[model samples]
Target: MIPTTDDPIGDNPALIVIDPQQTTSESEEAMSSGAASIPGGRDAVMENINTVVEHARSADIPIIWGKELHRPDFADYGAEIESCEPEHGIVGTRAEQFDPILSIDEDDMEPAEYVIVKRRYNFFHRTDIEHILRTYDIDTVILVGFMTNICVHYTAHGAHEHDYAFRVAEQATAAPSQDLHETGLKCMRYLQPRGIQDITDITARLEEYDGNQLVKRVKESGQITPKTGPV
Candidate 1:
């Protein structure tokens, strides 16, 4: 069973939106094509993520967008893993930019607000993500985005290692295959050990927890402030 946190989520939770780039790989193509042919496909997953994004925005929580991008010359080790580097303009290319379906507005694109250009599966690796979270005093992380088995899984692992209170939006993530998706969820359910809430449940939980009120209540009661610093 997933563990729960006594400190209300509103006390400052960060939303990490991971790897929702374009689809270009064969597996992704198969999934997208199959989804198009079926009643629900790629679009269904994107819509769910968008819904979660809206909820996070309404709650005034920070939304951190992480996209995988590599250098053109494979100067980074990521290119060593594959023959051809992930080019800039190719669809699903790490450099292709955020998926438009996410509906992130111009205001949400502020530099301080989002963590972009993540080259690896784990957002904290060689990135300012940890620093940003520390700067914002965010303790809990709600992870949502694409390719559940790969990037999502890696990020959650990193979060757990860093001792951050972590949550995954189950419905908001998509994998190349249903089996992979289910396996990823099972791994997160066991590995994460805390706050593995469904997208709907998390949305409602965020709405119910008022951050300002919680902060005020904690302060007024003369309670010792829980360390809001990095894990």
Candidate 2:
């Protein structure tokens, strides 16, 4: 459901952009035919992803970018080495870097933090994501990026297990196929009723984030003074 005026997705929140890396030419051959191509291609969701990023920036919300990088020696490959392409997301490779089309900047990692270096689909796995979230006092996370069925889906499970509420910006993510994309969203919604949401709703909630303090004040003291000016 879309967040309402009363049920705003308040409380401190962070944006976790999962594996927005460049796909390699050999990547398509590693997947089955059913999962070989994105419905409208990856660029279809780029606009939505950028829009969400813009809104998150304007709201002053912390933006954490997740990059999947595997060691050159393949020591971190584990079970994935058998099922996936070895060259995918290799360290020092273009695939390990964020897509230039993204709105990412050095400031996002200004203090040399918030960028999650992960080797697994789940960003919270063996990464500092949990500590980062706690450090920022973030209770909710807004997810956006590539492979909605893989990285994004597993990351949502990780967040749920870590006790952090999350919402997937439906239009801001894409999987290899439409069916898999919908399936991923369905599974997440089963975990959290309002987990799957539109980009519009996500942006709207972010724009009103400053009002969260007012909500907290009302709950703490049974009274609220109307503010006539900007929050």
Candidate 3:
């Protein structure tokens, strides 16, 4: 449901952008069929990702960009390394890079915003995300990014298990097919009734984020700065 005037996404929310670097910016058509393929098109989904990111940035919400990086020798990928067709997020490959469409380091972007690298489908596994969230007292997680059925789905599960109230920008995430996309949303919704919502609704809630006055405390602890002002 689209949140009405009052937003339940909470005041201490962090926007977790899961693998926006699914493809190189040069391959626009990868949205249809490729290792980077994302159903419902690529550019539009990416645009939504950026729009929500900007909203978070403007409202002092934390933006955690999850990058699925693997070792060059594939030793860290586990058994998938020996699979005939393995995950494409191998560290040195273009598939593991941030899409060129993203402005990762812009003047308007906050200096404290993070790019977190992980090897598992779930961000919480072997990543500093939980510690980071705890450092900032973040209790709410809003997810947006590529492959709704894969990384996004598992990350939502991780968030749920971690006891963080989470929501997924349903329209902001995509999969290789519409079936998978819808199924992914259903799974998340099953886990948390209000977990699936539109990006517009999510951003509306995000615009209300004022750092809950916790930003200063976290920064003093050397954890992270709550975004404020123009960034």
Candidate 4:
């Protein structure tokens, strides 16, 4: 179990990658159906994500990749289909899996232990993520991945309600539009001041934690900047 500490990251933290799959717009089906699509420019986002992943791995931090997958019959899909393309994330389809561009290497780490499947936007909703967190005694979670305004945003809420301090990799996530992405970051920052952080900052901190034998804890001064709004 991770030791309790005053530091925001605590003693043990996990990296939570949410829905790192190809956007509907990148697939052939989207061309035919004109379904909802994540905006382009995933290449840049994945580069930052891989950097964070590499550092987290170097620090021996537990990494959990969450992918959105639905039942073959789409029975698990709820009101989301009404808002999004119904065919997305269907079982036995490419959308249901992680994007090939991700840096997840099962040969280097146990695949089963590093991936979680979800049917909804919230990673914790009806998933074993809570159990995994409890097992690892994870006090903080670093969230990064697709649709900054949707899955990433909702998972931040899940982390809050589940009693886990969290951070969002600012440049490692994307949305359908720049405005929406910024809005998502603003919302998360409103939830936790200084929570929307750079991936490099997070990796540097993790490296410090690792080099310090993973036992040292930095006590905070209890200083926090009060936020007026979500900006």
The per-model lDDT (C-alpha) reads: 0.66, 0.71, 0.72, 0.70
Steric clashes per prediction = 1, 0, 0, 0
Comparing 2 with 4 on TM-score, the higher-scoring candidate is 2
Ranking by lDDT: 3, 2, 4, 1
Window of ten residues with lowest summed lDDT in model 2: 30-39
- Candidate 2's TM-score: 0.79
Model 3 lDDT on a 0 to 1 scale: 0.72
Instruction: Enumerate residue pairs that collide in model 4.
Output: none
In model 2, the runs with Cα more than 4 Å from the true position are 1-10, 28-40, 84-87, 107-113, 211-231
Answer with 1 or 3, whichever has the higher lDDT: 3
- Tens digit of lDDT per residue, candidate 1, span 20-127? 776555434543411211236567777877888777766666678877765555566454366332233233353366667777754546323465677677877778
Give the local distance difference test score of model 2.
0.71
Ten-residue segment with the worst summed lDDT in candidate 4?
Answer: 215-224
TM-score, one value per model: 0.75, 0.79, 0.80, 0.78
For model 4 the local lDDT of residue 229 reads 59
Give the per-residue lDDT of model 4 (tens digit) for 37-119.
22336767777778888777666666789888888776888888786543667777667656777876645644223678888
What value of lDDT does candidate 1 attain over all alpha carbons? 0.66
C-alpha positional error of residue 57 in candidate 4 after TM-score superposition, expressed in Å: 0.7
Candidate 2, 91-179: lDDT as tens digits: 76677667778877745442212577899889889898877676557788888886777888899899888887788888788776668
Error of 1 at 41 (Å): 2.4
TM-score of candidate 4 on Cα atoms, chains taken together: 0.78
